[model samples]
Target: MQSHARGHLVYAASGVLAVHTERGTSIVPANRVAWTPAGFTHYHRAHGDTDMRIVFLAPSIARLIPEHPAVFLASGLAREVLLALTGPRNHDPAAPDYSRSARSRLLRVLVDELREAHEQPLHLPEPRDDRLQAIARMLHERPADNATLAELGKTIGASTRTLSRLFRNELGMTFYEWRTQLRIYHALVLLADGHDTTQTAYACGWANPSSFIAAFTNIVGTTPGRYRTSRRTTARASQLPTVLKSPD
Candidate 1:
């Protein structure tokens, strides 16, 4: 809990949330945008640990914005443009300034897309009961296990019927849906770690690569290879090893 209020824009690049406040709680997920108005005290509980970008706009820059704490769904173009604008070169003066001349024009167009973006709800609900927490933890611990709802219910000491209702009422999804989201979210971490999709698929409990790819593509808006390539391509500051030349 915070004593003083503050205004900020928080983007969850990956992961999910269970946010609580007087404005009410929300479930948030990847590629989603949230702008908290000045003095809104809220505590965010993450569904899974995630990487995020936060731009705290002062009153001067923020006064122009109409909504005080608006949440929006980020479009594909906006997401790509943001990634590019915030790429490695932007942080390093020694790196070729991609902001020069013609490059500056391209950047302008990308920023415009972000300005017109709209919010979409990505939050996943959760149960207040501790028993459900234990079940959720088990699911998180073995994302690839593909535990059937019946199996999970048995382990958690709740009947499958009761668990199904609990999942919908408290978690806002059927057991299977929640599991799928968990798998896709975890896959992004593996991909970011430079693991190939095939290996990631198996490691994450996917029976095969195709299934994992489908799940990842559906939620992440891109394939694992494409995402990895984007990472490496934008990794402009990578140090190279020097070797002495022996022969021409």
Candidate 2:
């Protein structure tokens, strides 16, 4: 996974991803588009053979987003705008010199669409459960850490048996699986932040890069390098103004 930061925007895109947020985890399909706001650390991996698109925007583009990771509705128009903005054709012109002003115009339009796009809750809040809240916070803050059923039971003032039952009834997944997903989610963020997969794997608590690669490919449908390369190539191809340098 490769991610680069440009201005206030850190765009990370992949195909068929499963996203885990503080509230919960869900799968993102082609019909659905996903993104996280600036400075909001989140993770996603491709769920199947798919192509993902991400576009980050500076806070100056919109005042509505204050501080939080959010998912926005990629309306049909929004999708079209993103495609056009990222297309290779945007960089090409028949003139002797590419116009910087034209490239800026396209980027402006792309940013406008992103800022105006509708927001959605990829993960909803849980019922009034402070313990769950604590667990969620801990996971987001440090996804590598694991709590056994007995440990969590003691920490949350419940028994292992009870905690097991609650996890099934409330969270809908076993503790280990949930933790794995959380770590994987955060790993994606690290990867998108320009952290190497090997470092991300170690930092996110994977046994090794191979293990991380296995999980990443299985869930994100592509390797981290492929994902980052695509995003960079798309961003550069879409926004770079055509320039001609005459022989000196």
Candidate 3:
């Protein structure tokens, strides 16, 4: 993980990106954009054959954005603007170019678009307590585990009530709530890897496809089927390996 001198915006033109920082994790699918303010140590993991693009923001524009990392829904206009700014034309000397003034105007519009857009609940906050850390590690390894908080506590040496209070006080959510979020995060990665809904449901601990659909739609703002279809063009197995050359 590293930080930049200037804040920047990253867009996954295809596939998905997850931004990790000390605070938590933020999932950035194709329909969203992520902004990381200057000097926040973080790293990004590309999921599938991601075509990620980035645009650095000037300090003036950066201050208008949140100081911490955040995810925002990318409107059609916002997507177009981001592509235009980061597209090959900017690097290809023979291609048509944008003047400095024109670029500045585009940056202003981009920041304005984000301001008008609402923040997404895609972040899963990190916990600090040792007991909480132990619990998190176990579940991270087995999201499909259907064990209740009480059942999980038995293995971790903490009482159910203590664990419940820790989740609330330290993470600001209940055990089930955090697990649901964790499951959804894993579900996205699974889908990116070409898993069908039925497969993803069982793999992520959902009893059946229907239940998984309801929870996925409620959190991701779209059905798993639709999300899968949208990613089909970008994540073909044949082209996924190139992403490893540079995981940024």
Tell me the lDDT of model 2 at 217.
70
Worst 10 residues of 2 by lDDT: 239-248
Give the winner by TM-score: 3
Which scores higher on lDDT, 1 or 2?
1
Model 3 agreement with the true structure over 1-248: per-residue lDDT tens digits? 88888888888777778999888888888668998888889999988767777788878779998998899988878877887887656766797888999989998999999999999878888889988888788878998999999888889889999999999999899999999988998898888888899999999999999999999999888999998887664344213112111213
In what order do the candidates fall by lDDT, top score first? 3, 1, 2
Worst 10 residues of 1 by lDDT: 239-248
- Per-model TM-score versus the true fold: 0.60, 0.51, 0.91
The runs of at least 3 residues in candidate 1 whose Cα sits more than 4 Å from the true structure, single-residue gaps closed, are 1-4, 11-52, 57-125, 235-248
Which rank order by TM-score, best down to worst? 3, 1, 2
* Global CA lDDT computed for model 1: 0.59
- Top candidate by lDDT: 3
Q: lDDT score, residue 107, model 1? A: 43
Writing each residue's lDDT as its tens digit, candidate 1 over 65-105 gives: 54435566667775555555455555656877564564555
How does model 2 score by TM-score? 0.51
- C-alpha lDDT of all candidate models, in order: 0.59, 0.54, 0.83
